[model samples]
Target chain A: MLKAFASYMTYEFIGLDQGSRIGDVLNFFIYDTIKIFLLLTVIIHAVSIIRSYFPPEKTRKILAHKREFIGNILAALLGVVTPFCSCSAVPLFIGFVEAGVPLGVTFSFLISSPMVNEVAVVLLWGLFGWKIAAIYMVTGLLVAVLAGFVIGKLKLEKWVEEYVYQIKTGQGQQVLTQTFRQRLQYARWNTADILKRIWLYVVLAIGLGGFIHGYVPQDFLVRYAGNGNPFAVPMAVALGVPLYSNAAGVIPIVYALMEKGLNTGTVLAFMMAVTALSLPEMIILRKVLKIPLLIVFAGIMTVTITAVGYLFNAIL
Target chain B: MEIKVLGPGCANCHTMEQLAKTAVAALGIEARVEKISDIQEIMKYTMSTPGLVVNGKLKHAGKPLPSIEKVKAMIKEEA
Candidate 1:
């Protein structure tokens, strides 16, 4: 139905020439926009309902004092369903510390939450397919886990700000309880909230993708950032670091880049780097962690993301 | 009565603070709605920012902030 509507609008209503590149691009954009928004509405609402059940307080209780590897893994998983905002990073970090959750485990949660989100997943699935979405998610989680484990082994607790250890989260955390109706209400608002924030990015992504599909010549970027270039992955990560956008904002750019003949691994790495590591988040984290730890975090993420890009480039 | 808004001074935190004040004034209640900007102080209430504390009891915390009506209800409950 979506496909038919997209084609009708492109070919009949707009009267773009049939079988032309512009028609194809328009169809792709229209079909993808509708499919992605619908998927996001359903998935984000469901995720919000799940999130209402597992607030940060409950996640803290579940993760505190667990073994290292297992804790890191659990923390990364919880990061996905837990609704965390960058603004709350300081308190949440301290809360984790106060709960006896290891610094590394906390890092895992912090890394995965922002990078692997429902909007990104929905967009990837709608545009690329499930396999690519699955790859993005699994690699994202793996990167978080591996980086957290490495941070754990480094024993960088001393690098944390002195005050983080001293501050005690209140024991009387009021458990936020709501009725099913309230949860549904929250979900409705949550979906609208997410859509409002990312609508521009989605539109821009699809628009840019359409432009690329219609105008940019095939293999345009292949020579420079293609699989043949050994430095492509690192270069992509380097370019991605300072640039900041949410996953939704970045994926369309990824699609455009991939379409222009950027190899899969290099494009994926660029997306990960853009979403996973950003200067603003680092600045926010600076309140809890010292400069050195932040540096180490950035370094490890860059390396891991680059490696993943290369791995996928070679295997897939 | 005391109402405290806890956050590290983000946009949401400010909105929460403003909501508490409006809720207080609309209720015609003589209450102080304090904005707690200090992270240490904020943590003593809840891990999530934009936290609402009614008489030092955490009423709500985190994003997707409660509506103005809900904020009024919380204050009324404390009142």
Candidate 2:
């Protein structure tokens, strides 16, 4: 009787050990969340400081003289460095228009600013490595330039608010009075402010990501998102539209989804969609643009990026 | 050193103020922290807020106050 009881006890202990080990593996995801959040915070703050030195007014002048194809290239390059957020869009737009920057060139800057922010670049690099980061940067720039050229050709000048054109043309050349020291001070403050607003979003998204990292049923996500699924890319893009998050906040989730066996193309499409088509940004845009223009902009971005995402996944 | 939390008195702004106080206390720093709620005044230094100004230099903006270590580093760098 004693020998039988001993054997039973050993079996139960082994089972519990295996279960607890799995639990430990799951718990590691929490640490990953913390690490990612802290890293992103630092990177974003650094970018914010850089953006402070080059005010939007300065960018306006650069785009003005270089209008057309060259201007589009310059604007895309600037877009890679500038860290403008959704709120800055209208003011920047007005500034560019006031400076007589060609519509397509200015549009390129606007599209690139929010879609490929510094924080997104840093986060993508951290999550996926330099190759994916480079791909995103190149692909993102192409979309902005192409979209701007197309819209410019369409002659969307009538869409501009009259007040925007009347608001003192060439305000870009006005010398900012703030001292170098003061500018640095402003940059630091902006960095912290942006970080505070988005930190919660980052944490919430990462927490969801952590949970996904731990226990997403891989077979299910894969069956839908995986290879040769004709609808997968568009479906992913559509799914991403309503959701709003900065790239810094979404890349971790993307990584988690990928780990769960989601296709790279689908994940990329989702990332671009969420960043570019945020509902909050759309609501904000409504204050500035007519509904038709807003829909067209969003629709173009969604279709273009979905195609890019699929192409990337198939190629690499 | 004087620390100011600049914002439009939103919920997040208030939370930032409290967090700044807590972080300052945690570090046992001898500093006066004030919340600047006026939009006009906040715009004087930054278009983005809640801005964190330590010793008249903006330490952070568009984000909450950082952890205790960051605060201490700012103090050290400024000092």
Candidate 3:
């Protein structure tokens, strides 16, 4: 249906010539935009409902005081389902820390939370095939778990702000229990909220993708960031660090890069690097984590994300 | 009655505070609505941001701010 509409709009309504570049790009943009938005709405609403059950408090409870190996695994998985934003990072961090949750486990949650999400998954699946999307998710989780494990072993607790240890969160915290109807309401609002925030990014991304598909020559970036380039993955990760974007916003850009002959590993590395580490998020985290711990976290993330990019590039 | 809105001052936090103020006025209730942005004080109530505390008791926490009706209902419960 979407394909048919896109075709009709491009060929019949717009009256562009067959096989014309403008027609092709217009078709691509129209079809992908509508299709992706539809996918995003449905998936985001469902994910919101599912996420309602795993609030940060619950996620913390699930991992608190658990053993390290299993804890990192659970934290990574929970990070995907837990819906807390970076704004709540400090309290969430202090909450987890005060609850005796392992710092590494918390790191796993922090790493995976922003980088891997339903929106990113939906965007990837919509643009790329399911296999690529699956690969991205699995690798993201692995990086989160592994980096978190390494951080855990580093025993850098002292690097955290001293105030995080001394400040005791209030007990007898009241539970603002939601009814099923309330959950549904929350999901509806969440879907609207997410769409409002990212719709512009999605549209711009798809627009750029269409433009690239029509105008950009093939192998444009392959020479610089192709599989043959030994430094491509590291370089891509390095470029991605200062830039900030959520997974949804970056996937289309990644798609454009992938289309322009960038190696899969390099582009994917760039996407992860952009999402995983951002200047704003680092500053927000700085309130609780001292500069050294933040630096170490950033370093490990850069290395792990770069490795994942290289691994996938080599394999596929 | 005193009600506090706890958050680290994100966009949603402001909305939450607004919803709260509007709820109090619509109900015509004499309640002090306080905005709590201090991280240490916020953790004393809830781990999540944009938390709603009615009379120092947590009523709602986290995103997807409750409807004005719901806020009024919560305030009514405290009243």
Candidate 4:
């Protein structure tokens, strides 16, 4: 449908030759921009409404006093519905510990919340196919669960800041109940707000994709980072870690790289590293977690994500 | 009464601040609504941004932000 509109705009409206490179690039850009923006708006609004049901306070209550494996899984899944900001890490950490939620379970929520975000899922589905998107989500959850579980077993609670355990959060405020109308209003506001923040990144990503589609040689990236290269996954993850960007911001670059023939697994790992293991999140987490614990968390994430990348490369 | 909305100035923090202000006005109450963006100040009150502090007490923190009516009620309780 969008392609037809793009063709009409280029050929019938502007009278450009259908076979021209510029026309093809223009058509691709227009179609992608419209489709992605539409997808983002509808999906983000729906997710926000669902999110209104799973506030951090409620999530903490659900995970509080839960067992190991079950808690990890629940926390990982809830991380998707829960609203997360790195800025809230300290409060969230302190709140969870004070509420008697297991440290590992809280870590699961923290890891998955940023990694398996709605924007990342929707963008992957829109740009790639459903299969790749599903794989990314499942793998992201696995990473969170396994990493959190391992950290739990290590008994790293002692490494947390002393004040976190010492502080008492006296029956923290109750979750705000919302009517359907209010939920709709909040969702609308949230969708508009998110779109405003990410619109530029979307345009830039599609524009870059269009450029790659028009001019970049198909074999350029394949020659360097294709399936045969053993180090490609780790290299991608290493490069992705220091660069701080949300999924939306990185999708354009991912699109460009994939079009240039980078393997799917390498690109996926890169996206995970960028969103999940960002330096800023680490700096924020450092305030609550001692140095040794912080290093272990980063180390475990790096190893787990790298393994996921390699697994995908081997299978797909 | 003194009211503080704590956050790092993210969108939700701004919304919470606006809701607090509107609630204060709707109740015809004399109160100052302040936004605390500094991380240290926010930590002292609560770890959550978009926290609501009324007269030195932490009233609400974190998501599922309250409606204007709820905010008003919280203020009423404090007052």
For each candidate in the order shown, give its overall lDDT on alpha carbons: 0.89, 0.67, 0.88, 0.86
Q: For candidate 1, what is the DockQ?
A: 0.69
Candidate with maximal DockQ: 1
The TM-score ranking, best first, is: 1, 3, 4, 2
Model 2 C-alpha lDDT per residue in residues A129-183, reported as the tens digit of each score: 6777788888888778877777777787767655556555335223334676755
Q: Candidates sorted by lDDT, descending order?
A: 1, 3, 4, 2
Chain B TM, every candidate: 0.96, 0.80, 0.97, 0.96
Q: Per-residue lDDT of A124-197 in model 4, one digit per residue for the tens?
A: 88788788899999999999999999999999999998877877657445455679997898788778877878
TM-score of each: 0.96, 0.69, 0.95, 0.89
lDDT of 3 by residue, A1-316 (tens): 8899999999999899879989889999999999999999999999998998987878888998989979999999999999888888888999999888999999999999998899888888888768877988899899999999999999999999998898876544556678999889889999998888888888888898889878988888887777678999899999999889888777667988888888777887899899999998898999998899999999999999989988988898
For candidate 2, the chain B TM-score comes to 0.80
How big is the positional error of residue A216 in model 3, measured in Å on the Cα after superposition? 1.2
Q: B1-79, model 2: which lDDT tens digit per residue?
A: 7888777555656776877787778777788889986533554455445567777777755433455566567655665
> Pick by TM-score: which candidate is best?
1
**Per-residue lDDT of candidate 1, residues A1-316 (tens digit):** 9999999999999999989988898898898889889999999999999998989989999999989999999999999999999999988998899899999999999999999888888888877889888998999999999999999999999999998888865644677688999899989988998898998888888888888878988888887777678999999999999899899888778988877988778888899999999888898999989999999999999999999998998889
Residue pairs in candidate 4 whose N, alpha carbon or C atoms collide under 3 angstroms: A91-B47, B6-B50
Note the chain A TM-score of all models in turn. Answer: 0.97, 0.80, 0.97, 0.98
Cα deviation of A3, candidate 4, in Å: 2.6
Candidate number that wins on TM-score, 3 or 4: 3
Instruction: Compare candidates 2 and 4 on lDDT and give the better one.
Output: 4
Superposition-based RMSD of candidate 1 using all C-alpha atoms, in angstroms:
1.5
